[model samples]
Target: MDIVVAITLFVLALLIGVEVIGKVPATLHTPLMSGANSIHGIVIVGVVIVAAHATSPLAWVFIFLAAVLGTMNVVGGYVVTDRMLEMFKSDKSKKGEGK
Candidate 1:
């Protein structure tokens, strides 16, 4: 069935993502996440396109869930990227804070 295939693919992708990310070094994580964030943006675009054609109630539900999950991914990625960039702030910026 289509649902079965979709679920299987989703599970497989999840497992693969976990496996690949788990082996990355901490220092490389920020750059990798930044790139993945870009991919998440594209996912959002694709989900939007899919949502436009979603007609049935079940179809709409799946599209809604996908859009939400994709948005979370994009937001979380940017948050991580921002925190990582903060680590490299200039000395002047650090001293300017609360002074």
Candidate 2:
């Protein structure tokens, strides 16, 4: 059945996700977060497709949550990446005092 396949894929993805996220080191989290956002973009697309074809109120609710979460992932990732990169930018760049 369709539900069975969906659940199976979800479980597989969840397992793979756990394994992948568990391996990354804390110091690299910021840089990896940007890449993770790109990965979440794929999840966004998958969820959109599922949402579009979704039926029933419960399914819509699930789809909505997934979409919101995915959007947050992307937006938050960009914010963090920008801030991290901002810190890397020299103060002299702003003051026009660089060598």
Among the numbered candidates, top lDDT falls to 1
Question: Which digits, one per residue and each the tens of the lDDT, describe model 1 over residues 1-99?
Answer: 999999999999999888877677686676676967756566888888988898999998988898888888888778777766676464448778854
Q: Which pairs of residues have clashing backbones in candidate 1?
A: none
Model 1, position 61, has a per-residue lDDT of 90
- Candidate 1 deviant stretches above 4 angstroms: 1-29, 90-99
What is the TM-score (0 to 1) of candidate 2?
A: 0.55
Over the full model, what C-alpha lDDT does candidate 1 score relative to the true structure?
A: 0.79
- Can you tell me which runs of candidate 2 are displaced by over 4 Å? 1-29, 91-99
Q: How many pairs in model 1 have backbone atoms within 3 A of each other, for residues 3 or more apart or on separate chains, i.e. clashes?
A: 0
In the range 1-99, model 2's lDDT, one tens digit per residue, is: 999999999999999988887676685577677766756666778888897789899999999999898878877777877777666565547667745
Give the number of the best model, judged by TM-score. Answer: 2
Local distance difference test, each candidate: 0.79, 0.78
